[model samples]
Target: MQARQDATARAVENADNLARVIEHDITYTSQLTDLSIQAAVDGAQDADVMRLPDHLRRELLFDRSATASQYIGSLLCLDSRGKIIVDSTSVVPRSVNLADRTWFTVHRDNPKLGLFVSRPLQSRLNPGEVDLMFSRRVNHPDGSFAGVVVAAFRLDYFQNLLSGVKLGPGGNITLLQDDGHVILRYPNDGTPVDENFSGRKNFERFRQTHETSFLGTSGKDGKERLYNFRRFDKLKMIVIIAPAARYVFADWTSRAWYIGIVTALLIVGMLFAAQLLSVEFRHRLVVEQQLRDMTRIDGLTGLSNRRSLDDRLMLEWHRAKRSGKPLALLFVDIDRFKRYNDTYGHQAGDDALTAVAQAIARNSQRPGDIAARFGGEEFVVVLPETDGAAAAVVAAAIHAAVRGLAIEHNGSEHGVITVSIGVACTDTEEVTDALGLIKVADQAVYRAKASGRNQTSMAEPFGGAAVTT
Candidate 1:
């Protein structure tokens, strides 16, 4: 009896650990794909972006995809009319209209929806290939609906990610959205991906806890199994690991028949299995740490990426709104950056960008402050509980730091690397949401650039005149 109990406990522990590892991997992939989509949304906001030459527009909207090509199948920007405006895979937009698609209609009808993950479906661009889309709503400066930015992930990529796990005999792994729709299942059981399991007793029990292990009967195969499941904190997804109960106790059952003769051998075998599990668990912990770092940090500048910035912005926005405090944003752009890149090589341009990023990071020293590389030649700083006056001071400090670098850029009128900064604060009623604050700040940057390239500009109330600092 004791041996059977030990076997069952080990199986449960293994399943729980494996489920955690798989959950972290899936979450990281989803966030990375969403980041790419957000970048496209940001680029799409420029009304003239779609009018640029095809290659130039594609590079601006889809440059992030190059870093994550293994997971993202394609990045696309669709117009408000649901016509393909920009596609990452080709220079010319495809003749595809997604106006009738559910994903498109959901964002069009709901302006507040942030990111939406869709069920697997056949790809219109790549016939016969299945894709799962990660999408975000794009909005015009006045907060009107613009379009949708999509990152399509090939289903086979997920299959390969989960296929390496050695779930023992009759074991299975399932990935489901929070709504109980199955996204993927291991062993390719021929079950449809969209099958709804929310009505099942097993799924209801799994949803009862954030992380847990139990023994249950498989709804599909009708076999008793040890089930371990976990749900993500912020992501709308759950992971389940189940291995047949008979297989879990097979060794213990055999040992019980010969307890008098092979008792010592059984003890040694159990110890060996326990040691293997410990090693595997430690290895997975290391992998999870690496994945977490990759998801939050930008590869080029070593600062918080757009994904991290978006999360922190929303968090601070809500906190300030509740506390009746102010939040500030700075839009910093390198002056004459394209001219610098044309004069020097791309390597020199990269060095200049890194130097400018460091300058911005130095001035944003508060605990609640964050500086992130928004995209090429641009950066954003979030200052929680800060007013317009204080934000302008920080922007001035950033301008000074960049001048201190003294990086020579003969392409500029100033003969040195300089930055144009746009500052905006949520002290006025004009800014209703986090995205609105960003728009105001971005507009201020444009004003700064237009007035002259090397000064600070503060945003007036939305639609009001620009204020020079």
Candidate 2:
């Protein structure tokens, strides 16, 4: 239940954020449209019809895709007769008749309309792509209404805005006008373009209320969802962030499975103690514990095995992301381990490896931290909520602990055996995958060896400098 609540809270927060973004984009595009209109009016003041100066034309024609506010794909100046005078997209403007377009006709019919946003449609310049035109009435210098100034905003703009959002499998986010036209839907191959949802219960409820959030079933798929919406009054649109109910309850299901497993273990233990009460029961308990441990424990070092590390890393990664914390990994390798095995024989090498593993286990004191043997003279320590600095300190302590063993090594630079430690950490925002952390830590270990063994090094997140000790 707690897991379900957490998921819902996260979904609500994410929805709120997405709503703000959509609202802001609407306002931004509206402002840009107004600015474009003013520029057109200024440029056309003394023209035979509506002519733009060379500089003004170039400014409007400038490619905005490379810049931050490149949402506007193209701009155009039109005459009162709805004839294209200047197209910002081309050096030599092409003649396109816009007199029949809704945005053009609407502004042409009504001179009082300040800014009009049209429904999604294919662009005149690029017929393959869908676009929305934000247009405003352009009045002639003599006060009569000239043609409309149009700012064509590609639908790709909205797609880019919502691309970074992560809705788990089967989840979806959508942008819809209050009139029930679907502007965009993610995981769609542009098939839902201008889809009318006016008759859908969810759309009707969304339009009828001024609420920011709603819980309902999707009319399209019958999947129950928690929908959070923000209305863009200027654009007459709403951005809906919805995650499927099943996805939201996934964590709760995982928790229930864990609870069931623990209950079964408790029942088994109780039955053995109450009924079979003797030496046999005690022996059975030990055997059962050993059998359970075998799957996740290293037989030689008595430390957690690679399988345990993988599971713990996954769990800790999720916890760190949810808690907005950091997770650190220490990849420790015995320096010149192969040479030591060759010189000291396999038995002595094994003893040294066991001692090093014990030191690492002792140093990772936190209940949430895990120490595991990652196969053949390599071990890993996982520290949840620990940053790079703290992990470095732990790395230094592990170095000292292992050095205290004083296991002789003739092949190593140092007289006594030492281990190279590589530390890597990821903050909540940077948590893309758990495997990335391991790869980074492994690279850091390689750096430690390159710089001279018996040292501690930290891998910088996202290819930054490596800090060494």
Candidate 3:
């Protein structure tokens, strides 16, 4: 049984690690692919290389694919003026301005070879419109500077590449522009070109970063998405990969029969082991709870002890600080505990104290308040998110409750057992630590005892005292 539990734990850990590994592997692969494509695009960013003219380039590369066996790999074409032309008769974008073509740049000003890629044009000349254009400069047969030469590539190659890779179940990959337009998606959901999430927050952020990824809710189905992105300079596009956790986990359930059989055998062993563990766990839990109870509770009055008082004070002090509200601490002491305990057999004295503790607890009606036994006949109550006036009213209730308890001690001078209460409130300024707040409340307690017994005394956070004794 023990071994089975260990095996189950190990399996869970292994599965979690494997999920992370898979995520990391796909993220890295996407990053590398993006870099390679960008490198190809950057090679063409050179203005001088793009200066090649179309007419001269067509002449140089005219049917070169026929003579050179392979794909003419990349043909560089040039015009008479040595400038590259980007005019395409096909794929006329309705809203797009042709003057913005990258290939028409002043490449001569920065003469350097560049690798480039251009989207497909809708024309019979560009039968498969997606074109990969590589541009470079060289001298002509006459030794004069030749026009820029561009090698046109078909888009079919990339369409195949995007679909070929093995991304896990529900794993998605897309290429978009830094300007927020998504160029393409794998496992096509058929989102239109312009109507998609072009102006979303992600697109706005894309320009500020070269790469980005996050665990977020998917924009498509509102499901959890682990999104990874890489920016490609060659095409001036950002590539994003997203994997859904729910769909990924669902695959394991599809093979539930096999998993269930194994789990059944494991469960039998776990039950036996759990019995042994539960025995030890329960015993320890009981002892720990007893110790905790003792620490917080008063020995004589059966009320919350000094430790609880300190803890409550700390909580209330911090709460008041954060919210700009106020917290109140009330300290209560038996008017004559030592004398009463000495005169009455400590038994009767203990009874009187217990009565007061119960009364204080009963009177602390607010949900945001605590009444605790501080020590040796002394007690404290904490009120959180409160103001000075609120505290004073609570303090008065505590005083009244103690008197109403009607527990009589023949030795006491008063008709029955009674308490002197001190109220200190603060919106939390000047106190350096939680302990400082307690000290201020204790000072109020002292003043209440000084004024008289069976009454209440209130003080400003750090100032004048008012007595109701």
Best by lDDT: 1
Model 2 per-residue lDDT tens digits across residues 352-400: 8888998999999898999999989899999998999899999999999
lDDT of predicted model 3: 0.59
Better of 1 and 3 by TM-score: 1
Please list the residue runs of candidate 3 whose C-alpha ends up more than 4 Å from where it truly belongs after superposition: 1-269, 410-413, 427-433
The per-model lDDT (C-alpha) reads: 0.86, 0.80, 0.59
Compose the digit string of candidate 3's lDDT tens values, residues 1-469. Answer: 4444443344335434443443454344334433433333333344443455644423333433334312223333334354334322222212322223345243433345343334433323344344434344444455344444445444444455565554557667666555565556676777643234565555444445533555556667677655666655544556666666544445454456567788887897798899889998999999999989888877777777777877777777777788878777788888877777777778887788788888888878678778888777888888787677887787788778887877765656676778887776674353466676667777777887777667777766457777785
The true-versus-predicted C-alpha distance at residue 379 of model 2, in Å, is 94
Q: What C-alpha lDDT does candidate 1 achieve relative to the native structure?
A: 0.86
- Largest TM-score belongs to which candidate? 1
